[model samples]
Target: MTTSSSSSATHGRSPAGLDVSASFATTLHTPEHIRIAEELGFKRAWLYDTPQQSPDVWMTLALAAERTHRIGLGPGVLVPALRHPMVNASGAAALERLAPGRVAVAFGTGYTGRRAMGQQPVSWAYMTRYVTAFRALLRGETVEWEGSPMRMLHTPEYPRGAPDTIPVYIAAIGPKGTAIAESLGDGVFIMGIDGVSEEVTKKFESVVYGTAGSVLGDGEDLGSERLRTAAGPALAQLFHISYELGGEEAVKALPGGLEWLAVVQETPEAERHLAVHHGHLLRLNDADTAAWNAGGNTLVGHTLTGTAGDVLARVKDLAAQGVTEITYQPAGDIRRELEAFADAVGLRR
Candidate 1:
């Protein structure tokens, strides 16, 4: 089993990373986007894994792998509930073949991927078993799954044989998940700066903080059309997560949460799951738009959005707190967001 150790005190500033939602539009253009990010000195390209909302995560990562030479590539958080452990192991092996040491995989409890399908996140125990089995398969060891022995059957000549190593990161927001991450994951992936606690920074060698929103331009404010367009999709995602985790009462706690709940409530309870996440991280659907028009602007402060300098200051603070990496998910003009953020953070090799 994986266990955490005290990270080296000499760890430097957090490097910048790009997070792509893997929607059709984003997927089609990810190669170019990642190339631009690479040229701009990004450290990694993490594709979201939402089968209901986008193409296959592994396929997208494979495409990205073939296009980029250096930038690290992998899913931001693979939902184990969506695939057997063997399938995930194979997918990681394929990417390792393409990118060699450039592959890194992060596993999560299926927040959007499972919730959108009207299900709860998988238990941490299940995640532990799946990740253990996955690592064993990649190591060319036979592992039992559902009472059957399974292992990679690739010949040495095949490109699918496991590479030297693939670092595993677990996405966690709470203590239970974080504890599991420390015990089982090589690193931990989390959302928001608030997720970067002292215990996490000290426990894990790599703490990847994922955020969405844009690096604001010179004259832009929260109400600026460009800011709205760039930040709306991700801003709305907060409401989706809240509603799913806490239901109507929980959503009512956000800025304009009551109004947002009303719009979501308009859909029948039986099929509300479909209605709540219509656009997801791609665009703001009707309910999300309603939330934005009402008081979503007020929530911008809670996101990664800010003038370039302001965002950079935040990044520096996180680095001081021991965050190893920060992955920014852009909502609009993907290339523009990537370039702007890279420049803002002074990303370089």
Candidate 2:
């Protein structure tokens, strides 16, 4: 399991939950999907930001805000390097006005957003500045930037800020990012439970889960073909991130770590992002599929696929592990997956 530690020291009350949420890449579906999620009783809706392939993140979220009520909405994890803090804060502020007290934002060191552009993830120092400045500006506080003080512009006509304060969640993988969240953020967003150390649960106010899930047929293997078809690309992306963040050892920790790493390594550095693009939910090549098959599923990196009861049990198991919020993103027909998973989880329209 992925583990993260939260700091005992926090600036304010932390946000906590034991609820379900829906996540999607902009191209996976549309804003209406968020409404469907809300109808099905999901507590939150998260949108992905992949500038090269997906639709505009903020407008999509705005559409979600205008169409839905109650369910929290925000980027699943906005890459700090892609946009300036002021720009990010302005978009969030506008969305908050449309849906006050119901919007949350998460920040991350660019992965898809950066890699797609043939760049590497930004420095942790840059990520910290982006998040810290974004938070301060959202609160209408002045923060020094580029050798000058900057604050998100506020006007009576627009009120570009959250209701009281916009809740912030930082996407963390290793110790450094988690430590940053523990020290500065209101919550932590993680890809798997393995990253969540026992120490983290006690420190952060909220923990948001990110996972690839699909319904399973009877007697499916841990590395079932159906799951591979639906969520294989996502699983591939998981290993890709592991290798990118922590190198070979980290990728080895994944279900199909070594084999997949080999296939990924075979690709040219300029084309590396393609190996994990398109939400990494599907469109894998034969070699990649073979590598994935060679590596069986594991505790921390398996797709959520099973009978309704089985899926529910898995979700509960995660909740028991201090997962305050689970963001489910299926890899196939968005509506069908959402409806099925929603039903399986006992969520009703």
Off by over 4 Å in 2: 1-17, 161-163, 218-226, 242-267, 276-279, 282-301
Instruction: Estimate TM-scores for all models.
Output: 0.90, 0.82
How far residue 207's Cα lies from its native spot in candidate 2, in Å, is 1.3
* Tens-digit lDDT string for candidate 2 (235-265): 5655656666687798677666677777767
Global lDDT of model 1: 0.77
Write candidate 1's Cα lDDT for 1-349 as tens digits: 1112222111112343222221122466677787677666566788888889788888887887777776777888899999998888889999888877778899999878888888889999999999889888888889999999988898778756444378999998688888989888889988773457877777888888888778988777678888878888878878888887677888888887877888878889988999997877788888888888888778887788888788878887877787778888877788788777776776532
RMSD (CA, Å), each prediction: 5.0, 6.7
Global lDDT of each candidate: 0.77, 0.72
TM-score of candidate 2 against the unseen true structure? 0.82
Residue 9 CA error for candidate 2 (Å)?
Answer: 27
